[model samples]
Target: MPHCLMCTRYNRKCPGPIDAPLLFVDTSSYPSGKKPRAKKPSPPATSFDVARRFEDGRGIHGSGNLSEEMAMVWSVDISPRHVWGDAFFQNLVAFFCAEGRHVLGAVRRTPSWLHALPRMAATPPPSAARNSSVVRANEALGLALRATSAAFSSLETRSTSLLHHAYGLYGDSLRSQGRVLQERGDKGENLYMVMTSIMLSMFESVVATTGEGFASHNIACAKMIDKALEQASTGPAKGRGNNPGAGGPSPMIVNVFFHVRIQLCFVYLTTSDDRIRNDPIMDRVLLEACGWEKRRLPLNMQIITPFARLMKLQSHADYEQLAMPPTEFEHEKADFVKAKEEVDELCADICDSCPRSCYNIAYPPFSTFPKIKLNVFGFFSCQQYCTSARDGQFHHARYVSDLSRAKFVVAALL
Candidate 1:
């Protein structure tokens, strides 16, 4: 007799009689040397049935209600085979709910699409029942989240299987996103679509070995940000926006604009792609939308602006070098160096402004470290940049040296 599929795949010894019912195949009913007539197919096992099996210790014991149990089947820590299953997607959503704040850092506080994902995934919009566009977009977001989480897990475990699975999910997410955009046109500018774009960008940024894929994802994200900002500026029709309570653009949209701008700046800096560099008009629009001119910005933004400016200068220089004569390259190089110096000065100013208490909290005895350690992490990150710059080499070699020094600093501090 053939081995039971589950037992074969999971490498567990078949518990003969017990496995027969679960497999839904009755060998005794089939007579030897004769094919048995077809019987009515059994009804599919429901979540309640799965829950009972789990409760009886015949399957993995996953805590929670039936829906949760169904979702649990995909958790990497629980059942690795279901990496692309709906259950795994649910687990990914749960992971984001619990740890997304830490994983995403300061942006977590903002009311962005990511913040809305759990609710959207669990309850879904009532309109989704009637709207195919909304349904596809929502599924895309879920797939993107699951893919990104799987990619992160793959990084930690160095698991080839999980990595491949993540790519599969990412591909499906993109397909669904494309379908929604093709079908709905302007209606595709919803929060779920934006969230899908951002999540895919993050996944590409992490798992992409080459700059090409990462750069593509960044450009796509930039376009999405522009569309979203334009919609917010024009103002949606009465009762048309995602959140009725939001008088203006939601904090989430504003945060996403800033995040994408910062990310694009980094991409331009690394790739020297003029097309990917910040547009002055769009920057102005974002600044106006976020009310940056009228109010103090976060500490991180304050620090990031100078670096972004430096990169913008570098991007212009790159373009000028490509277009101008060799003799003119010297002038652009001089300009870049000057901008670099200003950035260095800004970094110094930010470091000097770092609170003494931040140093105290980051100091020693890992057990006593405060829960809010970003201050300390930020200080170290700034110091790392300074150390890397002092050597006058901004290439791969400098990165290595800076990382080594930063690790040592962290070790000593902890």
Candidate 2:
């Protein structure tokens, strides 16, 4: 199968900071037994930009404006202000915001909307009682954010030293998180802790090719998440945690949690792991927590939900088929066929819609952008405006990877 060359998601090679030229390979042009002509070599794509080191102006693949690129990736077209600090901390902050270079353009990947990452990274926790959960929480979260930023830098720069630094910080974060868990014991049901684990998993995903790191982090946090959700849903406040004076984490926490939950469930739905293949508990929590099954869900979610449900059901049926009676096995097999047909028809109707809804408006040749959007998603021309073409094709490529992931899921089910 022909996979995209511009993205780095799920271990696809990141084409650094270069643009996928308007040139597309058409194998059909060659007639049967016709000799193909060798084409003239073109100029090298300046390693396209992903993240940049301020002051030094060093980039991994290359460097370019991130603000406008961020705007284009978003559905609402929102952008962040240009980061101005020259300090290391400030660079980390800037990189955190720009890590979309690594994430490409998946909006839910980092949850950086409205400066969430900058705020989360820049705000140093205040001094509290020694060994207090507050102090440990601050250290773990603060360091995790820093490590995540470093991981982005490592990818952009392809620097082993930077990756080592990121790993060291990652170690610190783990230790701090362990302290929190140890100090609190069973009472360590913390939203911050969960968030920390997510970031750590993200760091591992970026730096490590094997999925083991990501899986480990998530599995460790699973019981904590389950317990927290149970408390939140059943607590007197309903949808709030049980701590008094703490009312609960903000609605923002819950909302981001909901999206990430769905995204991760979607992530594992296609995983090779048998223990978590379309986890039924996670599927149930996702539906109950966010209502992604409703008709009003986003276009992507609407198309994906049915298959998610189907895949979960199929995985279950496949696992139990040996013990199941012939009648029950046959019934599920019929249901699978019907579900697959319904999903195929549903996608066929909106097949044109995802392509029709968006297009790329190329910037001038002499402008800041190095390239223009011609994001070819196999069959359609949806622009993945992660950053300017002149900068890097991170967003465009990441979006492609996301599509590939979707294909993986659908393909498995079909």
Q: If scored against the real structure, what TM-score would every candidate get? A: 0.52, 0.49
Stretches of candidate 1 exceeding 4 Å from the true structure: 1-116, 236-247, 278-299, 302-306, 316-414
Model 2: pairs clashing at backbone N, Cα or C within 3 Å: 17-47, 17-48, 17-49, 18-48, 49-62, 49-391, 60-156, 370-390, 371-389, 371-390
Please give the CA lDDT of all the candidate structures. Answer: 0.55, 0.50
Residue by residue across 210-239, what tens digits does model 1's lDDT show?
A: 666666765666666666655654565312
Q: Which ten residues in a row have the lowest lDDT in candidate 1?
A: 237-246
- Model 2, position 82, has a per-residue lDDT of 28
Clash pairs detected, candidate 1: 71-87
RMSD, every candidate, angstroms: 14.8, 27.5
Tens-digit lDDT string for candidate 2 (45-105): 3322222232124422325655765856533321112222222245544443333232222
